[model samples]
Target: MDAIQKSMLEKIADLHEVPEGAYNIRSNGALAGRNTTANIDIVTKQDKPGIDIIIKPGTKNESVHIPVILSESGLNDCVYNDFYIGEGADVVIVAGCGIHNCGTDTSEHDGIHTFFIGKNAKVKYIEKHYGEGDGTGEKILNPTTIVHIDEGGYMEMETTQIKGVDSTIRDTQADLKDGASLVIKEKIMTHGNQTAETNFVVNLDGVDSSANVISRSVAKDSSKQVFNSKICGNNKCYGHTECDAILMDNGHVNAVPSLEANDLDASLIHEAAIGKIAGEQLIKLMTLGLTEHEAEEQIINGFMK
Candidate 1:
């Protein structure tokens, strides 16, 4: 572990203790400059990494890229060199960031993150956005991820947030080739006077390509959230976009999910719903002796089900 990576690890809680073959790259610098690579089993974290993870076939020439970034712009202005994936490789990638408010007013904190994925590679990417401690509500976190999948490749992307002092916006784009597949699931929970916006776009460029998008969010207190998702298909492809949101007292939610197909041989579907906890179901559970909060929690958990 280098000094910069060690320092970056200090900012994160519950660092996973790595085994012998697991690789860890730590960084406290801007996401553009902290790029690293891995082949077999690897683990890494930093502020942000500008590049993509490329997995190669066979044990000798496995390719990978890791970068950590922290930006003051707060907008989605990020860059990465091209990432390459070998003909056939299997891998798991987790990328995310932890931002410190440091008393900065909200106006200075708007930032966005972007990613690009390669072909014929299998990647499971996990993204986590969180805060260090109590801070002012002026910081904004905007992240955008774009992925391109090749033939016979698979990608799974998921996100989790622990609330923010300010508003947040997240975007995702996945482009898949023939015989490729992408599954995206996003989970978010918010508190305080914060607002969150998320957009998901997937494009199927090859025959037999498939995509699935699922979203779940909870709004509490005086908060707001919006989710927009789109699935595009061509050349006999298959795609689906589904979104559901839950709102609490004084909370607001808006969800728009759409699917567009330009080819007659393509198939697409879109579904979205916005509502609060099911009162009737909660009451029925409470009648069985569960407390109100407990019933609500059970309902929320069941929503994910």
Candidate 2:
């Protein structure tokens, strides 16, 4: 890998070198490397342009990384990845994409990921999207994620896209069975006329099922952002969603959050807030020997963190 590509790996996957467990690295529309452990298997799908990740029943404390990188300009790539988590297994899945475009044509990547979690299983999924280059070409990403949780299952998702990406559209949805639960935390930052749109929907479809979705974003320098989320409680369940954002320097942000409750025992709620950074926050940080720009940076960093 080139230094630029390796640098991208560090930012997107937290990998300084080849990881210890199961992993698949894709670069420039092809597979760069792959490995599988005893409890997990990774296989390329014959009918599609992606892979399937399988975690065996009762597997615990293991992880898999599938990170894709693009360096060529005028390239548009798409992939489909499916995950099957076995019953009673507890594991982590790390997946992200990085694009480096240095030409006048657009470089884009679209990934669709689906997860099927078995009964009593617990899974943590982390995904980050990043782009870097000094070219006029746009860096674009569109990611779609779908999740299904069985009875007694739990799933947690942490997704972030905080730098360099010029345009992105992220869509995520989940369905929970009886006694299942889901939690999603999303953070995004856009600058320099960039644009971002995010949509999340979750369904609490069984007794005692629950879901929580939260999004926080910062937009600067005429960038535009949209955060839209909906939670539906169809049975005796609970659902909540929230959206918070900060805008600066002609930036624009719109938040639309909604909820629906169909059953008598179902409870659903939503909240949204969009505003600029507080002057007091900037002042307090600036009093500690920091410039105005530095203070604003610190505040924005803290808010997204």
Candidate 3:
């Protein structure tokens, strides 16, 4: 791996070397490396911005990692990744992007990912976005994800952006079939005049289908954030959406959660809360031998986790 790729992997995956049976891609439309097994096929799309990954049928207990890195300044990279999972294939996918820009120019990455999961398949997907540099430049990201789950399929997704991103906008949508389930968890933290906005929509289109959407965020030091989530139920299905945020030091947060049920047997609900950190919790921690700053940091960390 190159110096830039090594640094990015360390920050995002905390890995020294690329793991066995994993795939790697760089932001400059280069295939950094890959180690595939018999159960998975990795193919580069010559006419597209990203690759296509396919999992064989009945393949179980498999894991794949696709990490993207950008080292140059003033660069904008857009990637479109597509995943096709076969029937009864159980897998975990780790995907993330890290940027290092050390010049006075803005760096941005916009990724569009689509997943097609077959019947009875289960997938756990995790994605993270991070930025680092000591320059007067902006690190921006805009991600769009679309998922389709077949009958009896299950998908769980976790996405996080802890720090260093100057701006971000996230959009996610999902469609679930009969006996399918989807769960999405999102976490974000922003500071220093940063801005973030997230929108999610889940459609339960078949009988017994279900979906849950949860979002947690922290904004501090003049930062601003907004979250909007909607769940639509079309059959005898269930859906729930929630958004919670903590704001500090001139931070501003807006949360809007909506639910729509088109069928008489459908059930849908939503909730949202935005507020500052509790004073009593901070005081209790500070009395336990921690300074005010330390207590606040600890609380924020625990809350985001």
Candidate 4:
């Protein structure tokens, strides 16, 4: 293992022993190996009222599970495994991966994350994948994640991916119960010749349940990207989905958004768009005597601003 990777594993070596409760894991400067794999398993019981996790890389798989035991509601309100957000409690989870190198050898990676949020509970989730300056070659990864929330619960999830990756398929699922709310935002930026695909699904299953999904992607050079977002609503629920992409140079991006409503009392909306840097806007800034790099930087700052 490289120094950075070793250091990261060492820091969390005792992760299996940490007493759970609002845990945060960060590996901003590490990388997962080209041929490495990881599986994390977490067990969260009511008596513990904490978080659990597993993170290590190499072709090895990792897995984690948080049992959803409701303190009030019965079994009918949540998903399987009693993974509902119980009344008044809160749970937050973040799962991410980093690669140091993906050489010419076609390395493959697959990551799966699953969660069950209890009724009346709140969960804030942030997931990110990053790798920069590694030149191995043809790298592919597929990440699948699931989340379930109960009545009056809240779920917020944000995901990001940056550098050294050729392609990624990310799938996310969430179910909201009565009066529950779910908000998901995904932002991705790709450089060099790469391709990425992202997919998200939100289900509003109860009365007054609300869901929102926002997706954004930035493609540069010869890179390509695709984003698919879907929202479904049940009885008296509300759902909204929006997808937007920015293209630069010879890069290309495709976005598909859809909304489904089973009940007339339910509301749903969906929109998508793909476009390049606004030349008129860039020219206006260039007229100010800014260099090419400065002009490009200004546009990027504006996009993110």
Q: Against the hidden reference, what TM-scores do the models get?
A: 0.77, 0.98, 0.97, 0.72
Per-residue lDDT of candidate 3, residues 175-267 (tens digit): 999999999999999999999999998889989999989899999999999898888999999998888899889999988887888999899
| Rank ordering of all candidates by lDDT, starting from the highest | 2, 3, 1, 4
Against the true structure, what is every candidate's RMSD? 5.2, 0.8, 1.2, 11.1
**Model 2, 158-264: lDDT tens per residue?**
99996899999999989999999999999999999999999998889989999989888999999999888888889999888888999899999988887888899
Q: Pick the candidate with the highest lDDT.
A: 2
Rank the candidate models, highest TM-score first.
2, 3, 1, 4
lDDT of 2 at 71: 91
lDDT of candidate 4 over 1-305, digit per residue (tens) = 34554432333222333223423332222121111112333333355223334332221112222211111111111111223333555544545554444244544445555555556667676666654334455555566778777668787887766555677888888787789898888878787888888888888888999988887778989998888777887789888888777888888888877778789998888877788777887788889999767888788766653
Q: Which 10 consecutive positions of candidate 1 have the poorest summed lDDT?
A: 17-26
- Per model, how many backbone clashes are there? 17, 0, 0, 32
Q: How accurate is candidate 2 locally (lDDT)?
A: 0.93
TM-score, model 2 to reference: 0.98
True lDDT of residue 143, candidate 1: 64
Worst 10 residues of 4 by lDDT: 67-76
In terms of lDDT, model 3 sits at 0.88
Note the Cα lDDT for every prediction shown.
0.63, 0.93, 0.88, 0.60
Candidate 2 worst ten-residue window by lDDT: 253-262
